[model samples]
Target chain A: MENTQPATAGRQDPTALPIGILAIAGMTVFAAVFLMAESEAAVGGLLAFAAVAVLGAGKLGLLERVRAAFRDHELTMHTAIVIGALAIAWVFREDHFALLMLTMAMLYLTACLGLNVQLGYTGILNFAGSSFLGVGCYTAAVLTQHTAIPPLVILPLGGLMATIVGSVLILPVLRTRGHYAAVVTIAFAVLFKTFLEVNDSLGGPQGLAVGEMTLFGWGFNSNIEIGDFYASFYMNYFLLALVITILAFALTRRIERSWVGLNMDAVRIDELAASCFGINLARWKITAFMLGNFMIGTAGALLGMILGFIAPTNFTFADSLILLSIVLLGGMGSVWGIALASAIIVMLPEKLQLIQEYRFLLFAALVILVLRFRPNGLLPRADRIYFPGWRPR
Target chain B: MSEAILDCKGVTRRFGGLVALDTLDLQMPRGAILGLIGPNGSGKTTFFNVLTGIYGFSDGAAAFDGRDITAYSSQEVYRAGIARTFQRSRMCLPLSVFDNIMVGNHKRLDHGLWANVFARKKLRKAFEESYEEAHELVKIFDPPLAERMFEPVAGFPMIDRRRIEICRALISHPKLLLLDEPSAGMTHEETRQLMDDILEVRDRIKDLSIIIIEHEMGVIERITDRCIVLNFGRKIAEGTYQDVANDREVQEAYLGAE
Candidate 1:
């Protein structure tokens, strides 16, 4: 054991270990400070610490190595950041803004991953993504309010309901191509919103109150404390969101490397070629639409349950655009990129509330800039080989 | 003569006022290379599209291996042992060569969503086998290409893309392979090499029939066992390559002789 430890330690860069630990410590401290501080000052302190770290690392000549590691293990770094932020929040009991934004980011990530399956992998234009999210939210809300079903049961059921709606829409939606299909989705979103507003049984324009969700008799609406770390309702929701997010991420990554993902890609690149290869075009299209909506619906249900309310305004065409922008800005089909994009979309406005009114304009400009420079996204998907000996030596 | 594998009877396709394929009847015996020659608008591609079920035929029927497939969808036709290459190569450029080829074998894959997620051990085994199969097919088809199986299609030359398309079609183990202008953009030497490869592939794969659409008369004459000529969306002549070339109607269709 002693000999093996020395040999393994020799293989890993000695500096990498300490630097990683230091970086984690620094990030944790900075996050704790940011969570406890006022919004405007928190952003400043966070940026200052980040700048200092970058500059210090550069001065120490460790920046290049750090950058290389970050580049190679970008997902690991992002995951670490998320875990650190949540851990800080949980320990400190900072449930007001940090936990809220973190929960929002997770929900957004789930929704964007759903969109990524359609627009990124399947090449389907779905402007009705928000409508699916709304479907999920409303399903959960209506069920919790009217029925005696548990939240756990209603969550998957919400996804099923959204899938049904998405599948039914696919017939007309798939008939159109490219921009035309996008138009169809946009119209569908509008139709869905109007329908929600008009239906009195669905609470019409006023919306409905969602009952507190319980899982195995443990109410998520209430707070529980661990030995050292206390959990608020937001923290409970945050932990639940985190669990769901990780599962969704794992599932998505698996699908991306599987035949199912390959077929979706084939369908996206060339429908004619995909069909010629014996890929069921309609089935795949329907699958992409329905599965994507399923994820979105799940997120929607979770969001509604956590918020304890639902309204037609929550699922708007504007919200759909924002979700799509998250996918695009994150580098279409890139999981980590989408997560980063969602984080920015969810947290940036709150951090820079001084320019809250101009947040959309800033986001638009940032998107335009990113498109101009990195049109493929912040992290365009690289060629992943399925078989051995396919990589360049 | 071998058994007729692909039979099209009065298969007609109309695009509103214009007929793309007019009462087209074609039959291909197993282990035969039949060349389809035509003018620009003579519907050589249209016939391929119709048989492959890309475009719905307005009339008549198409059968593969004695089974009626006129109403079959494109993917259904493929599952029924028919695969085709496009005139303009349709490659998934962003995808790895291995994935592009593996996608051709998708019909045989275990693609249950829940199964893929939950059944890791079985799925991994299936994936490894599929990957190995793709590699083996590429190695047998083009030994040199076996090394570059992971490279994206975007970096590949047009000829390489064409070869990869052929390899993809072959991986599916289709009984009838359709080559729609496979030599459209190739030089004479390249076309000759492609012809040799096609002939070699035919020799290797037993009972495989090919219907090649070509504008190059040399390709038609050298590669095809028999030639069918089309003009104005109708068959003008059908015979041996030499016979079709010498036919007055075929000559007029190409040269516009008075």
Candidate 2:
């Protein structure tokens, strides 16, 4: 009676939809909204229109029909879709729009992964993620202005500083249970922001400027050339971000499959049981908190480097809410799902600039709809990777 | 007396005005099976909690293998070679069967974050070894369950869940294993099979003492070398199962006022 339902739920099917067509369709709609709209408000409205159309298509199972069309070529379709999106983004010189949207997409992707490790995998709901982001930004800002070190040295230092602060702050907070932990972290966020605002040495409320980064006199602020075409500074920054994003993704994916991840999963499921099994609860909880903050701090440093400016206002409760929304809307514990969700949430509202005024309302409606219908997000995590070809049977 | 692997001296636990485990005292030698039977609210679970450091005692001390463990935390107590199972199943339902058992091997597993990220091959090798061991143990306990090692525990039957809980405890390689009604929801045959498996486990693991709480006299009579009967947070009788069953105080405690 027990071994019936494949033992695990929420696994995403490889042949779910013709993803290449979906990506092309999604990006084409995005590009079209950017091109034809006279005003930002019109773009926002058009983007909203496109989102609704997709939702309607999903409900009607039109996506399913398209999925069935490419069932035989799933792998090829997926690869083609990815290459197509990259090619389009490369060709389009929508400098301000493409660069900012793409950079922030990767930024949010990093932050969401951090939150996923804490809240999703370890079941520690930390509302103080933005505080760690601020810590990282400030660390970089302070170090770059005061020290002779390159951005490479300063960046990881920022993460280390955030880890130190986050580890100390979470100790007292982790003593509490689920909702209490949330409240404690929320208080910590408020305290961090307030400290930054009141302290005159840290530039008071006007904020600080982070110097342009260089690696051994190779200025990141300057544009680089490849073959014939000269890449923009933002594009260079985007490439740098892409490298970091891949590293972060690979590291987190590895951790997810490791024994430490399994231990955290145990603690998340049942704290008492995990304890009885000889798992140190505080140790694992702290590992999740500190490591999560470290990644988040790196994302913050990236944000600071790209903007070349820092402010207390940049890392706020609203930013924390958005970060949390990325985790929730993405689906907990699904890394790639979070990356996709981050891109959609960050880029969609900006591209559809028509509804900028009603952006929150639109986002709220979107989140509610996602939770209502696809509670597990667009891509749920797969259970195990089966390579049946190599099996003895 | 000093050979006792687990020793409790005047252990007391109070929740407000109510004393849950009142000045309880017990001792067990290595490789011995001690059955603790009491009516509901007689502090059987409370004593277990105090011993495992889940609940702090109001007074008195508990020692495990000559070390004072009264103030130790649950994890500390476990690392000191103690493990327990809940009266109700506490399986991590979403995790795979291999993972659930592997969790019990966490203490022995390579747990350093850097090791997990950088030294993955070594960690994976260690994990594979543990997984194989867990698989072997599962095969010995229940062969059918070993086949579903990769499946999630959510769909396992009640009996299998119970078996996995015991297996989880055993994987820790504890000196003292605390079983809280392992046969709570099982049929008569299932209970007998569980008892046999418990004895088999005791036979396999060297010097592996067990403290089991059971309501069924037959289980206590058949499995326990000695029994302690509790009533109203106080032990009223202690001896062999027949001796405790024949005692007037133990009889009155179970049957109630007449």
Candidate 3:
């Protein structure tokens, strides 16, 4: 038999770089227009256009071609995406509300990426994602109020605090499976809220005020004045959140593409098979749980600092469901899907006031529609490629 | 016997009041293919479970490669150079062929989180090596299948999936490979092909002992160097295939004596 290799093997598509850059530019323009739209009709029209464009791409089989191009030129595509995201801030430099919303979306994206590690990648169901975020927020709130430590220093410290608390929660979580495990997390979520509400030292139901994030004498809470050009203070928070989100996204992708991801997938699919193949089931589960909690905690800490105050109400069970919806709606285990889902989940309600009051219902309806039509998610996770420059034929 | 890779003394496994595997004494020499055959519910798989540490020994001990592995966990057993394929074909169907095989290569891969994330060049080098190893192993089974290395296993047929499962077990380069009903859900022709593939694997991978639990007498007769027959959770006969085929107890257990 002749030795046959895939035609595209080990070769970079010449069009990939240009296509990737164009895609990013297109997305950035759409985001800017969507953000600047004042009338509800304009916002709805843009949403419809996006929906139609995505559907048309799928129908024309262009989605796969775009995906292949992105995969072939990952570094280029990723850099373009980062630049495009940063350009959005530049476009809306004076729009405080847009910057604030953008920052919130990035923070939520970070938290959802963490949750994806456990729920999507590891098959560990965690319904109390907001509780871990609360752990981080509360940790930051307390540390900033009582200590002389810098808020930037307290950022990762809040993540550590959540990981420590998550370790305790995982004890019960580890003992259960499927819905039982979800129940354990749910109980923890309720318990955490009650603990915060009843504990006076932690400010009870009124919540606590968190100090501003400062790095080397630059307060993130202050507006920027660049010689006749004025930008909202939220831009500072947006930039920081963007950095954290990018790091989280990159780390999540690395984990998903490596050997650790293979082991986690093995564990997720079949514990018996994973164990027999030398994967420590408990170790992977704990690793995923702790890592996820740390990401959520850090994002929450930053969110607290961004908001300047965080009450128990901000991290309620309903809030957690919204995070879960983003993961489910985005397509489990797909980072790109999660990023898109978070953006839509965060921006949709705010953009259209008519659906803001019934946001939960809207989310439920959207999730139901997606699950019914596209169960694997809007953009399901693609196959893992071990070697660079190799695509499955 | 002294050079055996797997030696078990009084290996027993009991579930509630029923003894699934009675005090079974078994020895498999290095580089030998041992066939474990028995009627359904006669403890053939139960014995495998005990030996591989999937099920704890009720009242016995097992040693593999000169180490006491009686108390080892399944993961520890695998790390100690023992790998296995499941009876029901437990392939992570969503995973690519390379990914499935790499699951068994976990013992060889650097699993440190920081290393996987920060050490890109090192990780890439490791992945390239693994891909080559897995590709070569798959090529031994089917040259065509080797070309589709990154394709998901879900799209493969039963024989190819079985081949992939065997390749997964072989990727770790184990001292012993446990195949539980490899022929299940496969046609007779596919089984014959798989048996040839297994023989090819044993030849390519030096000194690799294999313990296969098969119901097909022809398969046991053709491939296995030695045969162990079980009846009522006890070893009824053990010897060459002809010896066990001629044993009165083995005959009685299979055909029901008048």
Candidate 4:
């Protein structure tokens, strides 16, 4: 199904909780953590958030409009960043907490976007997404850490590297098809893990540690002061993550509604019939796989930046399955579904800390129940999400 | 006389060692209804599959509108003005009845991602024109169906599903329409109305040609400009209704057969 923004009044239904409220709540919590924290960097983070929060809430009527404008996943899923930022403000408004949360949120958003491309639009049960993300992480990590190039150049290069590697893995396997396709992709992820553990040039099992990512003149290693907090290179790098995430989000959304998206849906609906429509089945299938993997690579880069470390164990098939579960629980064929699924998958374990290892089991069971009850997703997409152009009824 | 619109020469096809078609040659003149009749296991369906490129032929080449298309895919063949209905009713189940027909208009979509999003200038223009055309076709073909355009096609019963299938295929305004067992599960009156609709389609596109496959003699006699009979990949008879019906060989073939 395609998205057609319902009328304004319909969107602003009084019964439904406004999306902005969540954003505001997230900010308030971040502010408390930021202002009262002991770290000098924490104070600056708090001020940055306070400034952003004031702007966000100052125009209450506009904020309401913004809430109404929440179309898809950007609503609930992006809320994690707001919440995380607010939390950072609450505990330690110093250092790069606000920046870190934003960057982390951006990376998560990119991952969600990537997963949506595979699971939402294409109907592919890709369980190798995280492995590709690892590819990006490793690529960016090695280039920026080992070489002299700026991270700006390395990030896109990292995405390209992962895309090339992922395409080589995914394109040829498309002919194998169905549950078999997923199995092969998962096998590829495991293979990547094996390669990482054995290979020496990529730092072997311990993986590569990131080096400094100095921008043109901005020495990321330098520290700055804003209000009561101190800022460092980590904070700037985190902001960089937000930049990449926004770009990824826009691009993914565009492709989701484009001809590629529609044709991909056609593939999901019926391969034989779609083939009869002059659509090249092989090319589109490969392209979708590659594009999805490209975003995963970006996510991987962000993940690498956040931790400044990488290892073979990080890119396991389990991570891929977790991502798949997120997409499934959120919705198949929905951008928002991917976002919501990511937020839940990332946040739920923290909230249900007592469940410990059983959290995954609980999620798995919940996914099954959701599938049984709402076969489509939490927000089922429009089935005939057709472009009412060029073709007569 | 209308010019021959479809030509097949030395179109040979085989299933392993089994011959599905043996040097089969046929010509369908423009604006004519061609009937294909055969017993079970005959090559009628095989020929349809071959012409539509569902299965590659074992040998030979073909041309349509002065272009060789024997090597093209089914979709390519469709783009070159060929449309067909499935014997089992292959209408898109999830799409709306109208949307199924809109598929026929796929060749017409011009906008990429951005244009499709906002229905930008060129795409919006195309959308408006196409929607109008789909609406007009629905009104002319089945007035009642025109109103039910937004309903899911899967829910339609046997008759309406077939009708929607025909509507979808015809929406492309093909030069050649291939209907495989259009009346397979229909009542007599339903079959009659379907035939009438087929005639209306022919009239609407005067240059259009239809190669219809059927076992029913009544339908063959009523709609065909000429008929071809096959038995086990071999052509047994080719003639008009009276000519083929009166043939002694034809009488023998149909003896005690419905």
Candidate 5:
């Protein structure tokens, strides 16, 4: 007799929806408190409390239960998360600095997600993430300055330009593996910075001033006033960043769940086996590299417009390391983990001004600790499950 | 044979003047199991590697399904309807059982990024079909394993992992399947069970020809319709398993010359 029972049989919990909703709400509240905290002492206290809470939840096995709940109500949980993000924006509408930091985090989230495709999914070692981002930034800067192109078209154009440049780098990357591949990207990072510094048409070391992003007739830099309600102009960029981040997240998730992700993972895990099984290693590697570069480049273009400036110093090798650390600290191959890690990496330094100068050192120390203790990452990716309700018995 | 599914002529592979495989000629009829047996360092595995395009043939010609696949890359060789397992049991261990099997299903999958992301109904249908196919293959090998399709291959025992590897090769629906030392690290009882599974798979799938590199004489005697023996990269004997077992050169190669 054929076993025809659905794999998810008897695993459904009725409380999943409420638990998922509560989890999202709790996370939103925590973000609000973390963002609004004015004193260093308050920020430190909140961090310590969060650490204790997370530890306690793990001890009580609440983490697994909550994850299961979220898995059961995936669509509902996604909707809740989007609503929570919008709520955070509304809460900080009048606070320009807070809104700016939040927007920056969203943009960084997009870029980190892009990096995750290379480092996490396909195991392509890329130490020059910021170099790719710089390509996008400069592309946006030059196009906005010289041509009459709209910012919307320029955004993806920046990504396309980055993809073209990354295609050339991939030749050397494909010829090598492991540490050698990593060195190739590192060399590219240095070469890109030096190129920007030497080239006078690209504003040299001083960089170029980017114009404001105007959609239709509305300028992204203009403050908004609705009768009695008022908000900073950064709100416009914040919303745009949110949409882009959501799209990137969805795209990354789709890739992870499909045959494309399976082929990439096969190539990542064992190239010889993948090839013997009919997987085109170079083709998939190039696909991942170009796709990741496109996302990173797109994020960079929007970031250039938001900041209204592009400089070689803004895209130094150290900046690339920061992005790499975020991918590492988040745990390679875990998209949600990358998002959480990026939030902490982006916001904590800004909140604690005392550690701003030594932020790189702090990130280095954090990554080392995570590698030694929780090697898989803060929230390691779970096993890939193709069917929604499927579970191991 | 007039209906040979795999034909290799003058296959030669050398590394820095050391011949790993000498000028070899091999042919297998359709739906026949050909056992490749040799002592350690006798170039049995090397023959498999060369055939699968892992190590390029120094000089040779191999035709599979009547198409010249001598110069094909590994990926192209697979697309040419040739699939293989590794001597050391190569698998993406972190991947699930279903995923390991689906890796071989690339020939059937729609690989377009746009289709994967936006074609929801089509992707879902493909996923369902793949899941059913993988589940059935695993069930054919081991019924209990089919239930744990989502479990990672890392946790499975060696015998089960070997079964999964064979399943991975079979999932591709190739006309020719290559099995490299499927009994490398298994007990006698496990080896017996695996051979039974292999025979069962051959019976279940029609027109499926297998080339297995095995060190176990009992397995070769039972499952193979024909046997080829190698000694120091040279073809020492060829015939039925019993005929090769009685050959003087085969005995001298396995034991020592008096």
Candidate 6:
């Protein structure tokens, strides 16, 4: 209470809190009083334990200070959330399935954000974001499999490759307007997927097995123990997630406030109006598609590294819908909303394990309920939250 | 005066074998309101589109401010300072009102991709310029328009949406402004107000020339310095509103038909 930290975010997320603090502040405050009045030692002790547990939450505040100290400054809230989520996922490495799912969700969020650059922000509604993710996945997987190049080199190359492909897909279809352009972009994605599936050299059906990347002679396979816990591989995962998430946040925020962003928002509103303003639709659309998919590709590389596998079966049209749903459910062009939506969407199926065989039905029902109740997802941005009661930040 | 600002010399367009226009010629004087009137499908909208480069003429030449704009692309035409509103007032329903006008002023943006995305000094300057221009034009509509400019246009009603469309066109400060049925859906009072605003717009910019296609007779008669009447895609009459109103063909084609 006496000392103030440079970086502190007010939170009480039901995780990492001390028993004494929670007893004095959270649910236990009233519940603890009643238990003490009853003079039941077991209930009082339980309440005291909860209070002590909640007090440990102060560490979460301390973490913000430690993170701010270590970071190169410009570590925004968006990046903090992403890094925190990735770090937590890696911390639970014993559950490989959870790691796979969370990483995939992160990648999916990146893809949706990429498409938001096309459809949500600019009103292009590109069906090619998932294809770019697939392209990126295969690009890194194939490059790493056949050659001795580092993952970082392949990472950028994957982005460039997707950008080139994105441009090629956009150029001819530039004349198509409305849903026609969307259909054409989707057709290109299907074509790309088919091209990859038919190509024998790029691992046709068997899929590509990428060799591990070595950083300064220490391969990704090399693990160093930090006390009792294995930390080397986890550090690589966190570092990758941290860097890409930072770059994505920085790039996106810059775009949101840029002239091109202004132009994109214009194009989204009215194409004829945009043209009158002298905005070159073809030029900006291509640029946006390229920038968006470039992020998708980088995230795709991260996805591949985490999973250490890539196959055509994983990337499909259904995957695009999943990403698009995340964007729509999150409120189209909102960055934080989409990212948070991705996390919830990723965790949904596991949380729905009780429904088992009817999981898809349960998922669909849950989505309907969300759409019916809160059209915007759990946390919505100021602009998209249409209710007058909600205040803008 | 000064190449007549906009000169459509013998412009003709065809839809399959149907002759929409047969070498129609018109001269729009600089900094003046030119009204276009005709029965439905009488080539009035078609003529406006041809001039705006939204539609290509089959035969004839149109020049704007001494430039041979006959072959200019839509983008080129727009870059050349030509902006127009739609007849039905098609607005980006999802975008906020201010963004609607901001989109309209898109051509004025001077930033490239790098500058735009990075918000470098150049991008900020470009946005500032456009924002200021938009801010001024939006004031004519109302005070809330400038304040609520961030609201998306699609959710706006008939009047605000129409005004937003016009403000968007005006944001770029076009040399030649085209209004396709601007007073189409307004009440008598609204039309009167709009006509006064149009006249004010002309009075403000000495270099600004406008070609307005309108169905509202009151607006056409009150605001237009010169009026052109078409029937069956032929120039039935041209002159002052009195000159066209008294023309037998024009009267029979429009007022008589109604």
Best by TM-score: 5
Higher-TM-score candidate of 5 and 6: 5
Query: Candidate 3 residues B208-234, lDDT tens each?
Result: 999999999999999989999998899
Interface quality of candidate 4 as DockQ:
0.32
TM-score of chain A of 5: 0.96
Q: Write the per-residue lDDT of candidate 2 for residues A1-393, one digit (tens) a residue.
A: 211224322333443445536655676556544654567677667758777977886676665544443333545654564564455457543364576677778877887788888988899998887888888888888888888877887777877888998876776767789999888888888988999999988887888888776767877777667677766677766766776776777677777878778877887989988887778888888888888888889888877877888889987877787788788788888886797788778876765566677877876787788789888776665443221111111
Q: How does model 6 score by TM-score? A: 0.80
Determine the TM-score of chain B of model 3.
0.98
- Where does model 3 exceed 4 Å of error? A1-13, A390-393
Error of 6 at B250 (Å): 1.7
The complex in candidate 6 yields a DockQ of 0.33
CAPRI verdict on model 5? medium
Interface RMSD of each: 4.8, 2.7, 1.7, 4.0, 1.6, 6.1
Ten-residue segment with the worst summed lDDT in candidate 1 chain A? A1-10
User: Which candidate number would show the highest DockQ if scored against the true structure?
Assistant: 5
Which scores greater on DockQ, model 1 or model 3? 3
- Sort order, lDDT high to low: 3, 5, 1, 2, 4, 6
In model 6 chain B, the worst 10-residue window by lDDT is: B118-127
Give a tens-digit lDDT track for model 4, residues A240-302: 665676677667665654555656666776777666665667766776777778788877875
DockQ value for model 2: 0.51
**lDDT measured at residue A177 in model 4 versus the true structure, 0 to 100:** 82
iRMSD value for model 4: 4.0
Off by over 4 Å in 4: A1-106, A211-225, A228-249, A384-393, B96-99, B111-121, B144-152, B158-160, B215-218, B246-258
Q: Residue-wise lDDT of candidate 6 within B1-258, one digit each (tens)?
A: 475888888999988999898799999777877898999999888887776677788999988888899988777888788888888887777656656676666665555766655546665555556656676776766666665655556566687787888887887778888899987777878877776766676677668888889888888888888899888788989999999888888888976754
Residue A30, model 4: lDDT of 55
- Candidate 4 fnat reads 0.37
Clashing pairs in 2: A40-A353, A40-A354, A41-A354, A42-A354, A43-A352, A44-A352, A44-A353, A44-A354
Native contacts recovered, each model:
0.80, 0.74, 0.81, 0.37, 0.84, 0.63
Better model by DockQ: candidate 2 vs candidate 3: 3
